[model samples]
Target: MSDIGPESAAGKRTLRRALLATRNGLTADDVRESAVALAARTLALPEVAGARTVAAYVSVGAEPGTLALLDALRARGVRVLLPALLPDNDLDWGEYAGEGSLARVRHGGRTALSEPAGERLGPDAVTGADVVLLPGLAVDGRGLRLGRGGGSYDRVLARLERAGTRPALLVLLYDGEVVAHVPGEPHDRPVDAVVTPSGTRRFR
Candidate 1:
């Protein structure tokens, strides 16, 4: 395990190194297709069978097959939620329509292009969700996840844990990024499973 938070230069350097290592192995289009395919397979699993409402992250680098999976879920009458970042850097869950429904919504330094049906909800709203798909630069066999340096998911997942509800934590990563371990700290949140282009695997 390693010390966490953006305050530490060392942690940031390690994260940067890991990200470069991961990205060096993944081409843009390769990751996009893989993300979509793996997402499709993960959603088909029995764990997501009864999930009428689910929450997923918005990917920055390569658009993961998140939209495709959301559309499929919507066709099946599943309600989907995406993150709407608050001023305090916390996450607020919101409804997400397909890509066509997107509109620009701005925060401090980031602008979110969100779906039309987007409705904001507190962290508590996430507990009722059956599945929560997270994005990561890298994830390890022990379930440790390396996020994009922003602590949004960390804070939100921690809040969920405090409420005693365990949502299925799923990560989408490039196949080669999966490893034996990732540097982690007390504030770092781990995923239950990881899905890559190769396949979906439970982290133990």
Candidate 2:
């Protein structure tokens, strides 16, 4: 784990803002093209290809899209799990049936999200996953991810740690979102790899 200093928080916030701004600047067509490229790269990862079960999320708006990848995984007979946000911001799990199985959900003061409209699986269901696909604003060379400040995935990571489950963690992002450094804290666990539109970067 990387050491966190007094400046880490401010630096993280600044980087988050910059990354969000850049993502917002992308046109719809640009996001679509990137999503296609990202899905191909992510699907080629050995971790994803070998996993029997994967916990992934539906990409909203400017985030690197995941609908195509989710469907592809389902067609491959991989059990795909999607997240449903809980009242406290922790995520609940559900099976991804297909594009039609998702419902548009709007949380308070947040952008609308597409979530699975299936049976609700307990949060611990993620423990059974062989690989977990995480959403993030950016990821540094060290594999520290900068999330959207929701802290939802933080709870998910904490739950996995408590259960001693060691699943391969991955983040999908645009080529530019991979950076040299990301301000990280002790609770922030590094990911095993990042799949971007251009390629994948693995961390030790």
Q: Which candidate ranks first by TM-score, i.e. highest?
A: 2
**Whole-model Cα lDDT of every candidate shown, in order:** 0.73, 0.91
What's the TM-score of each model vs. the native? 0.84, 0.96
Q: Candidate 2 on 31-95: residue-level lDDT in tens?
A: 99998998899888888889999999999889999988998999999999999999999999999
RMSD of 1: 3.0
Clashes in each model (backbone N, CA, C under 3 Å)? Answer: 0, 0
User: Which residue pairs does candidate 2 place in steric collision?
Assistant: none
- Candidate 2 Cα deviation (angstroms), residue 183: 0.8
Off by over 4 Å in 2: 1-6
Clash number for candidate 2: 0
In candidate 1, which residue pairs clash?
A: none
**lDDT digits (tens) for residues 1-204 of candidate 1:** 565665444665576586666675667787677757876787777777678788886565453556667777878888878877777777777777777655667665664545344556766777878888887777877888877677888887888889888778888776777876676777777789888877888865
